[model samples]
Target: MKKDYYEVLGVGRSATKDEIKKAYRKLAVQFHPDKNPDNKDAEEHFKEVNEAYEALSNDDKRRRYDQFGHAGVGSSAASGSGGQYGGASDFSDIFSAVNDMFGGGRSRAGGGAPFGFEEFFGGGGGARKGRASAGIQGTDLKIRLKLTLEEIAKGVDKTLKIKKQVACKECNGSGSKSGATESCKTCNGTGEVRQAQKTMFGQFVNIAACPTCGGEGRIIKDRCTSCYGEGIKLGEVTVKVTVPAGVQDGNYLTLRGQGNTGPRGGAAGDLIVVLEEIPHDLFSRNGDDVVYTLAVSFPDLVLGTKVDVPTLDGAVKLTIPPSTQPETMLRIPGYGIGHLRGSSRGDQYVKVNVYVPKDLSHQDKELLKELKKSQGISPDAHNDPHAKSFFEKARDIFS
Candidate 1:
């Protein structure tokens, strides 16, 4: 059974575009397959999130879904089962949109076969229609890489070890021992067989890939020993990825031709690297800007001091001006994260948090009493119109 789109995303029916995007991003990061490897439940949740976002993110689909529910949205992305919809064409449109969003589109290098779900389900065929009978492209793979604030602030290189299909070294992906094969009698080297049936409407012809020889159009006398007859073998492969600086969490990088090798020496798929930013101990990210809270004592605020502030680059000296009020926000220009695609750097904001001593020493108490006397602030100064209010007095402490 299909779940409601809003329910799947944990959003309200009245959610706006931004809210919908934020909710989807949060869920995508949490339930992403890379983050929860070997967990089927997480994978299911990831699909559910994708299905919900695909429906609600679009204005037309959202309107249809709001009125007619899942049936209104046509095919759910999670199931990819071309159920009853407005028409047969809707299935392709829905899945195509989803595939593009999930990094399953055509190869980034251009003129390559698709790794979309349509191809996997015998719809798009990955390769061009005429060439699909000759070559089958490999499946795309996704993995998550966690980066610290320091690494993200500056671009870093990463090495990943993954087990994926590669062309068998022995047979050179020909699937035959001596690289020799004979045409199949079933399809007569056409790679497809035709079946004719009589229906109520008229005669119907069904064209399907030949089962014998598995659509290769030829039979191998001696199959490859390394990869059996599949022409591919699973092996551990090392892939190097260059992560650009300022890449936000949940954003992904695409490495062309680094995924599983295609069957029968077809084009290899892409490797999608989704980045996860590890939380920083002292800094919080807001876009490219970094937020930091600096605690200062009353004397430090009054006397001013040079303090060390932590930034992605390193610790730097920040000057606190004399008589600086609490909650003063100081901007350190160009100390935050760099632009992902540009050279501009964001600023770091230091918010001052005043700290008060709860337990005063005996001499401190006496000094405070003397200071109050000198300032002419009586114990009953609350009734004085010129006196500071409770809020004003506590501003530094609460700010």
Candidate 2:
């Protein structure tokens, strides 16, 4: 028996269109065949998710399914046939949903397949049935790039070396030694084969790529010796990337057409660079601002002093007022990381820490004993009326 469409997608019956789409996107990515290679259960779950989405994504089909379940919509509404599972246009909708998730909306010129569909499906299946002769797009490549806090503060340019598939130079990417090819006998040069299956509902016709020619419509009579007829080989490429300021960890940048070159004179893919921020030894970042702890001696805090603090650029003088409390934060404007989009920069916050001597010498203790006799040196909250409370100081630090 067919499962309930809402149950298959794990959505409520009254779920909105966006909610349904969100659920479908999550399930599709989880059970996609490419992500779960050689797993039969995952493949079945993928098909089920696609079928459920096909029926639910459309208003009329969803209404019919809601009223009479699977019988009302039938396989025709989901697959464009009364007996089959899915068709070319049905998969196109699935590809559209996936493309929207990845922030890619560009399609090939002259209405070819969408940008990521070919990469995910290998330019085969129903999406590229009629355009089998058209060259396939290469798969996208991803690499993690480590960036230092200093580099992120000031945007830096990086050159990366990538190893990927490049077109074979021997055959000039034709995959034929003599540059000669013949029509495929299985598909009769049409690049596709159709099969009719008899089911309980009716006859369903399925059209797919030709296996003999691998959907290229033509077969190479003489295979290339270097690439073994695949027209691509493992090679290295150098790519330059510019990273903007204030880009956080897990942020990524995409470079178009910088990835692996497709086989048989096909278009190239994209390169995805994911940013990873290296931990700083003396500083920690909080949004655009950076925080550093500055330790000062007890004598320095009692009597105002000037000390140098470390910054990304260099050392800068910081002022400590007389009787400044511990855990007080001092702000240095325009000294932190630069804003991502604007010229303005965040402030650098210095957290004050009192440095206490672990072991005092005999002379140091005698001097401290004489200073302890002074009434002003005793701990008294009434001594300073302007002194801020702990709660007030904490609020100032965070606010």
Candidate 3:
């Protein structure tokens, strides 16, 4: 039996559009083919999630599915077999949706392929037309960008050198030495050729890009010597990228039309910048906030003293109150990383630890022995009602 659309998406039947979209995004990311490479189970789950979202995202399809279950949304309504639910056509929509979720900018142009799936799915070679006729889109490029805590606290701009396919300068991307071409004999200027395939269900007609002209409908009579008639060459270019503040690891920013240029003046591809957070020497990140450990002398903790605390910006003075306990956390407002959205910044947490000397001089031992003779100086004699246990302090730090 087919799984329920709501069940496949892990949502209730009455889920709102926003709720459905949120669930779909979570599931899509979890089971994305890129994240779970070579995992057949995850790939199936991804397709299922896309199928469920497709049926639920649209109000009309959702209403029909709700009234008549699988029959209403299936290929032929009468068959109720769902043959077209997970077909090649749906993959395009699935990729487009994923791109919208992670693209972080403008939508792709009309004829552009999403995530360069054409190479994987044979350019949607099943009944889908017009795309083969249109100019082929260039493949997207992905690069990892490492940022430090300081850089993440305040956004930064970086220039990256990328090597990719650029349009040939000799023939101006036309692939012809004389800048002239003729219509393809195979596809006859249609850019696609049709073929018949026998399947278990029935005979199916498949449409694919023409092999002669590579879907361009035209062929170069005289090939360009520079690019060997491919209309592109591998070259290097510098791209300026502005990384936003508070971007966590695994997060990515998309630069539209900044990837490899399309072959023969087709649509350009996108540049995907994946952010990687470099480990900090003195601090660790917790969500938007940063945690830092401060080591102070025993006297500073007991007698109370102002000490310098390291922040992303610089060192700031932190006042320790009298009788401050060890493992106590202090907060410095607006000293941490900024929020990804909005103007607010997270507070930096300073965890206090008493610094103990590994080796002490005879004079230091004599002074310590003298202080131990005083009342309330010994651990057994020290009794504070407000003092927390070691475990309690550890829990408070995480909380």
Q: Could you tell me every candidate's TM-score relative to the true structure?
A: 0.61, 0.64, 0.63
Query: Candidate 1: misplaced stretches above 4 Å?
Result: 1-128, 132-134, 197-200, 358-399
Candidate 2 lDDT, tens digit per residue, 165-264?
Answer: 8989998877888878888899998777766644332333545577777667778878999999878889998889999999999999999988788777
Query: Please, what are the lDDT tens digits per residue for candidate 1 over residues 36-101?
Result: 756778767777777788788989988988888788877454345323222223334554565565
State the TM-score for model 3.
0.63
Per-residue error (Å), model 3, residue 66? 63
Model 1 earns a TM-score of 0.61
lDDT of each: 0.75, 0.79, 0.78
Error of 3 at 271 (Å): 0.5
In what order do the candidates fall by lDDT, top score first? 2, 3, 1
Superposed by TM-score, candidate 2 places the C-alpha of residue 242 at a distance from the truth, in angstroms, of 0.4
Model 1 accuracy (lDDT, Cα): 0.75
Candidate 2 displacement at residue 161 in angstroms: 1.0
